[model samples]
Target: MIKPTLDEEKKETKFSKKYWKYDGLHVISFTKAGLREENQDGISIEFELNDKLKESDDRLKGYYLFGVYDGHGEHGDKISDDCVEHLSKYIAKRLYELPIVENEKEIKNAIKKGFDDTENYFKTHDINGIKGNKVRMSGTTALTVMMTPKKNLYIAFVGDSSVFFMSSNKSKKINIEHNCHNQNELLRLRALRQKGFMYSIKARSGRKYLRVKDDLSNEIQYTRSFSDFYIKNFFSGGLIAEPEIIDKVYSAFNLDLLVLASDGITDRSKIFNKHPTEIYLSYLKRYKGDPNRFVKACDEMIKLCDSITEKRICVDDMSIIIIIILNGKSEDEWCHIVTKNAEDPEDWDNTTHEDELSDIDDQDIYNQNSNEVDDFLVSVPLSTIPIEYYDEDSAMNFTISDDDNFD
Candidate 1:
């Protein structure tokens, strides 16, 4: 697993110029390569409000954007990098172009169109690679959330990357994992099978697997993602690029944290009989509502995962975005955001705000280098097949073994 050293953390103590704080929200984010040879995950967090908002459209105020992408196959990284870079533009265009009314369905349609346009853009253009090889046949999962000051939270999710909205008491999963084993996903594949677009098979272990069939009798692991035109061509309606959109109204006060993470973090097996959310909540409690809860959480993840026996460690690239809702909001902010218990003042962890640090550099925290994690040695081979685990705890943990080889 990739673990940051104290020196690296010290050097990065400077607040990223892009880091912004509004009336009651602090977005803290980080992505690590984990055990993967290459970091195939990509994340983006943007607060397009106040000075960050475009002058032409001051109406775009109070908009917060968060995205996470997990790449698969050899050219997976490019797919994620491109998806995030372009999707942001598409989302912004829709936000600014459409009528500003809170039309949840319309906004979701716009986001779907954005994903389509991005995928099409990849198909038409050639992405130049270091070895002069054009990236072609790769796919990535995408998850995006848009929070408007209008008290609406919109989510456009595809593939397996997970999204969780955490309040003081519970953290609810906002999206589904589009994989062969998921019951909903299985239903989708079955529906497509009726159209002769997809099929399912049972392995020797009696485990059923969904696959997009090819002319050569090859059965590829099924995923709804952007690109991988080869699968698109053969699978009929087999693979989809359309994202599932979910819209909800949340109160600023009731919400304690919003977590967006790649499958690497969520898809790990249970350790010590603890669920991922339970473990995460443990860290949140330890931090006592600190603003840098995300940073501290990631650090703990590295430590815990590294300490685990090799077989149970999370091996894929891990990325996370933590939206911490600061205290001291007006009564109006708490109206719709109902909460059972108010946070205790004594529980607050008082610490210097990162932005107030004297030696902090003006570099952006969400820059490209934010996800380029290093320090740990060894990389696991890339994997595309989703491992199915019956138990929820097992589902959250991934096997990261050095001796394992992929053909």
Candidate 2:
């Protein structure tokens, strides 16, 4: 049995925004604090697999893990930071403990245990001098993906953060957002018999949306998350840490792009009511097979979100991770191949639609003065906040050239 090596782990700390290029993967990530004093978002990108696993299955070679953690509440930053440091380690430990790597179920179980163990750690230990009560009130949403050498992707997530895959000039959402607005989530909450579990709240645009309320009267938009122990204890099965896992297999030529983003980027209010994936795919199409222009496209997208934040349309931290699957080819070669294989723009579904915010009952709580809503919708403009940029090499087998410096 081969033990996991700490020396090979390439995990970055919270808010380390940079670009990384590996053997067959190119990653560009950015995280900015929007209208908030502190950036509560955390990111982790790691590439590590023991030699034994690679020998057991060729598909396991060159496996890499990346995740985005979006935290909420007073101590949100602390909880997200802890997740960045510990969650990947727990997952790796579970994989190492397995004697035989057979099917996707074993791998999915390992990933699930990682989420459970991370939640248990927070439940038992005090974080950054924060007591159990404070820790219980704070939590984060996690979206993680592990990609293997054979183009197999294992995606697991909780809360509203999302993952998308783009190939053959088409886009597909890979994970479901766990929130009250989702019908399946509503059904689960109803089965629990948690009173006042669903309520309506108005956004800055006067658009009302359904949110889940706990026994403590805290309005939560997400139905599942890590931590929030206070709400979990207040109501029966109020919030959970269990993650939904799914696997996708893509051919080398068809795997063009993978995106992992927080709700700030995907939310309808921030992006002109179009699905974020549609907007992202359109941007990639505009670049026209130019690898050098890909980063610029990402910058433009983030700046669009940042501009909205500055106008106080919607104020929430934003983070995005864009991974270009190279399939062992050069960056330029990969871009040209994707462009050649893509379909016409006219055939794409890029229409903008109105949000379904009026589906809830009129008798439900019209929460205009919820404390949680007030705290999240504060008026700290993004213009007043400085953006931090890091240009150092943060990943193994990745190069940083002078021309490739961050703007």
Candidate 3:
């Protein structure tokens, strides 16, 4: 496994000034703490395939993985940090063990097994000497994308973090957000007989948030995640670790760029009037032919999000990874290709300006209420049930069985 160098780690912990190249991709990532004292966000960028896997199959030679984790609750920081360290290794290990790295189905199943192993480990192992059950209250949302040598993309995720795809023709949101407010997610919970799970909690600042209250009455924002074993143990169907997967081929979608980020980047704010995708595309168009200026474009986007938290209420911690797909061309050669096919600047700008912000509502902009309730909630803790409510059972031991259904 290839780990980040000490210098690279320091640069990522702060803000990255330049983009790092990995095979056919140029990547730049940033993560900064918001109003919270601790930053619970984490990112993973793995470029090299395992030596064993490369020797096993030539098709796996250029495999790469990228992910972002957004943690919540008391031990949120540790959960996200561990996820960054463990998830990629688990997935890669599973792939290496496969007899043959054949097709998309084999790769997808490997990713799912990796998630299951990671979840089971957290459910049973002690983190920082904290017992597994107590640590179960903390969890994180994960979004991961794997790119094969053939340029096929396999995306899998749980929770609100997202991956946005941008091409010359169109831009699209790739992963589904798993939250209580999501209609389909709500319907799924309702079908499972999880009634009264949805409610709006009013913060001291009077900003109300719609959240999912588990059987134990622990309020949570995400409907699916890793390490939130408290709810998963009680009502496994309610909050799961299973991730939704989607595949994209290079020929099907001529993707030029991919943006993976936490909800902090997509959160509604007074400063950003349009969709985040539109705003990013606009910046890309402004610096079409210049590869160096593209780095500045990403910096400006993060700065804009930072400006929002400073001017208005404290938003969630922001983490973003901007990827430029180089294919087989040099950076300058790819830039020229995009420039030649780029739409007129006026046309792109006018389209974004004319488009109405119909997708998001003003009140429903922010889903996480961490910053608004940090003060009072910290002083007066919510009452809890007896320990018997979290009684240990064989199921809690996390032995994966053939009948184990996380779907």
Error at 332, model 1, angstroms: 21
Model 2 is weakest, by summed lDDT over 10 consecutive residues, at 398-407
User: Can you give the lDDT of residue 279 in candidate 2?
Assistant: 59
Error of 1 at 177 (Å): 0.9
TM-score of each: 0.68, 0.73, 0.74
Between prediction 2 and prediction 3, which has the larger TM-score?
Answer: 3
What does candidate 3 score in Cα RMSD to the true structure? 9.7
Worst 10 residues of 1 by lDDT: 357-366
Q: Model 2: residues >4 Å from true position, as ranges?
A: 1-15, 49-61, 100-102, 194-216, 247-253, 268-270, 273-278, 284-291, 328-330, 337-407
Weakest 10 consecutive residues, lDDT, candidate 3? 376-385
lDDT for each candidate structure: 0.54, 0.63, 0.62
Give the Cα error of residue 158 in candidate 3, in Å: 0.7
Question: What does candidate 2 score on TM?
Answer: 0.73
RMSD to the native, candidate 2?
A: 13.3
Sorted on TM-score, best first, the list reads 3, 2, 1
**Runs in model 1 with CA error above 4 Å?**
1-20, 49-55, 129-134, 194-196, 199-222, 247-253, 269-276, 289-294, 308-312, 327-407
Q: Tens-digit lDDT track for model 1 on 1-407?
A: 11122223211221111233555665555566655566777877666633332456566677767898877767878788888778777777666766767677677777788787787877777654422233656778898888876656777887777777766566667665665434555566666655666433221111221222212113333357887777777776667787777656455556666778776666442223333444555554455446554456556655564443143233556676666565565433432232323232233222213222111111111112234322111111123234551232322223322221111
Candidate RMSDs in order: 12.2, 13.3, 9.7
